[model samples]
Target chain A: METPTYNTAFAELEELVAQIEDKDIQLDTLAEKVKRAKELIKYCEEKLRGIERDIEEVG
Target chain B: MPTPKKLSELVNEIDATIRNRFVGQAFWIKAEITDVKKQPDKRWCFLKFIEKDRNLITTEMGGVFWSNSYNQMENFEAATRQQFASGLEITCLVKVVFHKRFGMRLEVMEIDFAYEVGKLENERKQILERLVKEGIAVNPEGSSRYYTQNNTLEMPMVFERIALIASANTDGYRDFRKVIENNKYGYHFSVTDFSTQIQGDAASALIVERLHSIYKLKEQFDIVVIVRGGGSDTDFKSFNDFELAKAVALFPVPILTGIGHDRNTSITDLMARQHKTPTEVATFVIDYNGDFENAVMQLHDRILVTSERLIDRARRSLDTYKRIIASSSPETIMNRGFAIIRSNGKIVVDAKDIAVGAEIETIMKQDTILSTVTQKQDNGNTNI
Candidate 1:
């Protein structure tokens, strides 16, 4: 699967948080939701900090 | 042509005639100081003054401040808190002198500091009025379309790409780079510094050109920042240019300004999101990204807490269902002194359905007995 953008990752994390808070969510899907949430958080943190060291100067 | 006058004699004649008109007479004159140079002796100040006609310098004159006059001017500056520098509009009392060698020049006698300040204030007010009339200034009723256009743009979750406009070797640019590069969060910024003249005659045009270039590559940048280090009020005058202000106001991307003047807001400052200094602008970017990071951190905590709670809830529910099922098992019921009777391959539920001498099976928890029924019982009466 392709990596999600920061906004997409954040949105997914929020949805996962909401689903986990839901009382009607099935136990079978609980683990799946938690795993996905963790993945999104990692993707977001990497996107936030990942960049080259030098600043590019334009005219 | 008359008498073929000598060059020196004609020059002397002209000087006498000019002196006849201006000698020993003082008049108050209003003009801008285009340049000022202090002599090595520290007692004399030479200045070039110019009269501007609608942004064009139409006339020029030289002026001198002798030691006695310079001392008086210093006292005036101390009282009025305004410095005599280039780009200052001043009304000074001067006596015109036609020198034998240096030609015509004004001799400084006194300065009207209050008048200069009032003139600047008037000019600022006029510019503000023009901006309002042009429908570009912030509306008092909170409905200015142009002033609020760039403000309505959503800041990116992470400021990955930034378009920075500042002089190449300025303290402001250095300070901004230092703060952003050394942010404690380790956030990375892809800064593209568009070095340009930050202040001076060419500053406004250069800044406007940079803005256009950024607009062409607008998608490549997240935000545009214009910053400058501390300078005199004259140096900041370029920021008040109408063209630069208009460009910033109508910029497609969000523009932030840190021109480093805390007292008065420049036209560019009014058009863009203004900060006190370049460092503050960098701090704003850092804090902007930090907010999203903090939010993500909060969400991470929530997910962890909620997942654990959910798993614990599911476990307790499963345990309860398991207990209920175990308690109602057939073996458990049968172990409590009950027997299940079977006849003709089916459990007999009613006694009337079976006749005497019928073959049957009695099943208990540990044993099953094959027997024949010799009696039929109904409600406390037995028939054999």
Candidate 2:
């Protein structure tokens, strides 16, 4: 699978928050959902922090 | 018709008559240059001068810049940074000379620098007017100079991939690279150089070609940047080209110009999405990325805070349920001074539930006691 973009990661975070806020969520998976949300947040934060990209030259 | 004169004799007579009338005379005249060529291994140049009525050439004359006067041509180019080539209009001092074989020619003496500059300025005005008339740009009003389709394009939210149009040798290109590479925010971008000449007569065509190349792969770029080193005002002449300006104005992707002039804005600059010095353009990109990062970080913070609040609320709710369950236990109720009476195997809550002679067990927090029901009492209350 392709790596998620920052926008996509943020979107996933929002969805997770919705699930967490809803009373219908099972308590059994609450911790697991929170952990996944934190992971997505980290992924987005890393993307923002700079990674070097190759500089290409063309005619 | 009358006794035909020999060709040489007629030419000599004509030349003598020409010299007799205008010998040792110099005149300042306005003419357009054409077919200019420098003699090989010699400090002399030959060219043609023409006078035009509208676009039609009315008169033409051969002209020369002798070795002694060549420095004047050099000085003109130095001052204007414009090529002293064909199509250039100049007010120049010339001496009319006539020879039997060469016929009539003018020896160029001096060129008017201000006149050439004025001509260029006039052309610039015409180009700007044409752009507005053609609906390519809005008429600049007040402080706003240009409003074009390209300028109206929305910049990408993140400038990660860039198509860079600039000469590889220019200091502007180096400065831009240094700034972007060393940015404090460490925002990295994929800059692809579409190297091309940034000045001279052919620069506009080369740049326009580069823009075309970028168009083919438009999806790969977030924006296109054009930059050149700082130089004389005339050094930025190509950027004022109408064709280049039109290309920039109509480009599908946003373009940025950093031609390095503070006093004058080129037509390309007016049409582009942003115009700044090379270093400043780099800085702007960095800042743009920084802003996006800040927004993302803020969103991260919000999500973190909200999720924590949700988990904390869940925990508190669980704690409340635990307390309620513990407090509602039978032992807890009995500890608060209530006894549970059991008849046989069931708890008795009403006087009618027990017979007059039935045996009962009373359960309390600390002890259980066996007892017998001696009588039945009638009371209005029946609910336990």
Candidate 3:
């Protein structure tokens, strides 16, 4: 699968957070979702604050 | 070389002939105004009436508006909402006037306001028709509102790579750059300038060429922005050209136009994804990125709050379980003044369970005592 964009990753993270807050969620599923949510959060954070993104004038 | 004639003699003959032919009769003539020179003190103007065929001047005539006709010019400007200067097409009443020394010219009298307006509107309508025929624009359900393919494209959440199409060193470009470069959020953009003439007859073609150039490097830019500072309607005329509008409408990358005009959205503006002032476009880009950043920050706060809540709840449950286990321990019961007795490795709960002279071990919180039962007596009440 292709890597998710910042927007896509953020959207997924939000869904996982909603599931984590549900009282009836299965513990095993909750654990899996939490792990994926952490990865997504890290991806979005790096995209927003990455120093490697630089400006270059092509013309 | 025909017998030595005075220069005035021949000039007078020509003037007499012209005056006799026109007889001071005002004739309605159609022409484009050019080289208009207005004299504020005299309240009159000098102009040239020209006829063009395919961009080449075919016929030209000197014309004049005397002081008495100044009001007519003002009225025409007011009615048409157009400046009565060079490049204006009009049908005006003029009388042939010949002066011995000044030669011959047309003296302007009245202008047809409707003719001027109708001509401009007709041209615009024709271009719009051609665009529709070419399938470049869609007027859904035959309604007044229409959109082109470029207009239907979705703009990105934030634009980081910019292809700026503008005239070099113009205030619009400078203003746009200033806002983007100094955005409060410090968003960095990679801007490439594709400068071209943005006004005059050749502007549309020049702009079209620049669009093609940007197409070659389309991957380098997220959007193309066409910007120019405010100018007279004539200066913005090129933006209405069919060729330029078609190019903009067919462009693969989204185009944003901010060629300033108080009224009348140009065809190029219609084909673009969005249109606004240069400063406004800059603000929009900055604000879009700001919105995303705000959302991310909010999400981060929510994650923190939720995790803390979950952890606190789990910690409370653990604390309850620890209390239950600690309170049920034998040491805790012994501290409450209870003892345990075992005989033959079994708990002695009743007198029949233990025989006469049976040995037993008594356990208390702090000591173990050894004892033997001499006789067994069963009592209904085993109260201590």
Candidate 4:
């Protein structure tokens, strides 16, 4: 069985993106989402960097 | 050489009754042992027997597995022990020979060992180890690192996704499930098992090739799991190759291995982010995220604490401003308003500070009237 701990920020970011695209979001909410999105972006960037380094080592 | 008693002469003397020497090479003949002996001569083992058939055929034949071929014989027996049983059906490669002293002999060469299942497993392990040491990252899950200008290490936490590189349908699925799904912590993870022979001839190449395939999907995964289930001691040989270890050290996602066997550590284990005894790398990940949760919770608490502190500070600042407004009574200004007059564009602090003919004016909030600075007041005057 999957645990709630398995949900990464990516899932949250995807949700935010969906809300923006599908719902009428308030400007204040948009600002908060943007801030959260920046944090998620940072998380993704770190994940990708780790992958690159691993690929390089394997090579 | 004088023949002691020629079989043909003996038969003719008896009655010339034997027409032919063809004893009908009948192999279905049953025999009961009257005596069994190992001859002093190392070359052959002799058996004395009483034949039971249509006619009384009492005979003994020497049986031999030559010392030169004895090694092959022993190995063959060892391999086929699982299938070899008494009272079993028999089909062997054999030849019949006649000796001057002994009447007849049966020579058997090849014996079947029921099935060649294990033989195939071992050969596959050899190939897997060879491919790994060659410097190709056969197991796509391995550790990696990056650096920033501040010399701070940015270690991104990779979540529970690992591409397990192993043959599907083997013990891969079973072990992975036991570790990830059925654990007390209930760690969740997915395994994309690549089914191939775990051992024997084709195992090595298949494992390495699949490792390459998973490695290509680095962007899609956080880690890689190289796993196989418990088996013989030698079953772990596949992971011992240098190329495999090097591949693990260099994989895109950190490589985690749970090869199952507890023999000497393989090269892959040394190079991996973590090495486990089985596919329960999920347990490790769960605990890792457990720490992460504690950290986030602490952050949440600190935010609450800091907010309280900030609100307290703002309240104190607001109170200081309120006190200043309350103490500033206009009586201070009204005392000066009666004594001073406005002349031209300036306030006349005293009559001496103003000159005659200056168009002075008395001012109050109600009215501004023209006047003359006719008097001066003393330094300590309490005027009426």
Candidate 5:
């Protein structure tokens, strides 16, 4: 399975930030955005410190 | 075959003839030294002087430095601050001598330290010139398309998967791992070490091969990092190889180099994002992701602040509307000593609207007074 690229994760985070910053966002949408933001932050932070280390050999 | 002299006799004759030709002559010869071995007594230095054709070794000859000449070589290295080690290109004054036992060997007499430095400088210049000509060197003006190929790649905000090129047993690789693995922010780096020769003649080809492998799996890596621990200038020659530099320049993914030379920059450095050391490269990756994390944190704060301000504004608006509604309410007006009159289930706003002898009701804040209209008055003077 393919993992999300950093760029994709970061772009989603940026969009969430934008939505949260909007003054007219609906409460429901705001909640959704905040939840997504939390998820992205957690995912990114975990990736940054995750203990999964894999080293592959190639020609 | 019968006329051929004995092997030893021919060898002796050949050795004597070669000696007679160069016995008393001494001149400077330039070549790269390898397989260096210093005697335990420190009285002699034995090495091979090699000539290369491109990346391949063309010729090699054994050479020796006697105690006196070895002492001179040490002084030369000290004065120049360049180590006399394997892979060093040196121009040294030597006597061409052929020994019956050792065959052809150059006897070191004097070392030309300046010439060695010049040779290195010249090689660096040539590499730089070629890189510029090939349009692979960095040009701030964006005049060269090839130079911008790897540099212009959009760097990922977070560094998750890294394609690392280094020797497995090197301190550079270890330092890189230590820095990333123990980062304070707990940033995880999915690093894959493509172990390869980091120095010497085959270093360039090995590194290029690893890069090709990574390129094939470019989707798995965000960037390619070429790092090494500190080394002598001679060891860094591989980093300056034209082929390796070209490969780095043309790589699909962005390349980051940390070859660990404080004084000199290699051609590969010009073609890729250069860092001073392996640890610094690791720090760069961490910091890049940290910036994104910080932005997320800042956004979280902004959301809190802006939402609070919005809620406060909404509450104030609701309070103002509530006050307006209360002030205009009929009950509140009636409580303030005003009366409402109704006639036949209809509000009678004017005295003329009610006929004489009509029944009417007066409404107050908490009571209803039933009464009959005895007279209807429309003028200033009224009798009830």
Candidate 6:
């Protein structure tokens, strides 16, 4: 699979999170979507954390 | 007298004579036609009359009106000031017949037009007033307070398997079933009508019987429709009881009421999730579900569009990042005659990888350089 773009991956992560949170989503589909959302969240969080640490160290 | 037949024959003859004495006699007695149904031969008017219930048991009698009597009563009721329903009390002259095989029957002959009154309606209204006072029949404003909690619908498309809490075999049950099935979305309906008598002493019992059955199979339907033909409020008073009201309110699914009466709202109606004046709860069902379906579809569409847009944004950004990475690739740098060099199998930076007496190598864009180390330096202090 092609690696996701730095910016686009975060956007997809947000989208997946939103889908999980939406109340109207079917109950049966919640678990799988939530798992995917967590993975995306971690991926996005890792990227953001690295940037945060770099900024802190430079300052 | 001497030529009279055996005792059995004489007794049977007397019984026949007594029955014939009242067969065609015209007399007026007060009554109301609770159910007026058209049959193949003639219209059958189900009649009910209270005879003071001598033992305090409210008595009811059925009267069949073939044709002439039906027309008369129809016209009389239409022209009269009082309603011709269950709670309606009226004065009429009925030709009472004691059929040898069919027991007592009444053939209404003449209606005392001036005798019709508002006694039944008033009684029913008074009962309603009492129920209201008892806090059982809550007004609309008061009812709204009970709905302050959040109520989001879980099931999207509810399977409507209706059990019409009506009698086993009656036109009231059949007519109710027909009217509900008349609409377009009628194809998916599964209505099992327990045919029941509309108005009589048996009326309340039959209603409770049907209600019991529907309540038993509560999981099969989202709501139960208790429907009957338009008739006396008294005929359907079983629906107004606190027991029935509680049954409906506490039912697994919501109970819907289509019990007939345009102007009068029963305690059952107040307890139900929805109420319609006539025997067409499907109208309310269709409208309610239609609104629900529309909202769900809108939300579903929103989910799809938003997901697609997000995924698309992700894909486009990935494409741009790939392009930048490809531009800075090792093959591109090598083709430009630049090289990544190492000395003694390690990348050369500050020449530390070179040992004082060892051979060193360098990789250039086009060639390799080999040399022997002849100098040593520590923190810029050199020994040569």
lDDT of 2 at B248: 95
Error of 3 at B127 (Å): 3.2
Stronger candidate by TM-score (1 vs 2):
1
Candidate 6 residue lDDT tens string, B97-161: 66555656676766665554254345555655665566555445534312101111233265367
lDDT at A49 for candidate 6?
A: 56
lDDT of 4 at B335: 47
B106-198: candidate 4 lDDT, tens digit per residue: 554543333232443354455444544454434344433211111121334635666767656666556675666675645566656556665
Model 3, B155-260: lDDT tens digits are 7777899999988888788878999999999899998999988877789999999999999998888899998875443455688799999999999888988886
Candidate 4 lDDT tens digits, A1-59? 12222136556655766654444554335446655655654565455455445544643
Decoy 2 TM-score against native = 0.65
Q: How well is candidate 2 docked (DockQ)?
A: 0.03
- How much is B59 displaced in model 2, in angstroms? 8.3
**Residue B273: error of model 5 in Å?**
0.8
Query: Each model's TM-score, in the order given?
Result: 0.70, 0.65, 0.69, 0.45, 0.69, 0.53
TM-score of chain B of 2: 0.73
| Residue B11 in model 1: lDDT | 89
TM-score of 6: 0.53
Tell me which of candidates 3 and 4 scores higher on lDDT: 3
Per TM-score, the best of the predicted structures is 1
What would the per-residue lDDT of candidate 1 be over residues B75-142, giving only the tens digit for each residue?
Answer: 55544334566877778899888777888889899888778557656766677678778876665765
Off by over 4 Å in 5: A1-59, B1-43, B47-62, B67-90, B95-106, B138-147, B230-233, B377-384
Give the TM-score ranking, best first: 1, 3, 5, 2, 6, 4
Among residues 3 or more apart in sequence or in different chains, the pairs in candidate 3 whose N, CA or C atoms overlap within 3 Å are none
lDDT of 6 at A52: 50
Q: Which residue ranges in model 2 land beyond 4 Å of their true spot?
A: A1-59, B1-28, B33-86, B92-118, B140-143, B231-233, B344-346, B365-370, B375-384
TM-score of chain A of each: 0.77, 0.73, 0.79, 0.72, 0.73, 0.65
On lDDT, the stronger of 1 and 6 is: 1
Candidate 1 error regions (>4 Å) = A1-59, B1-27, B32-44, B49-61, B66-89, B95-105, B141-146, B231-233, B377-384
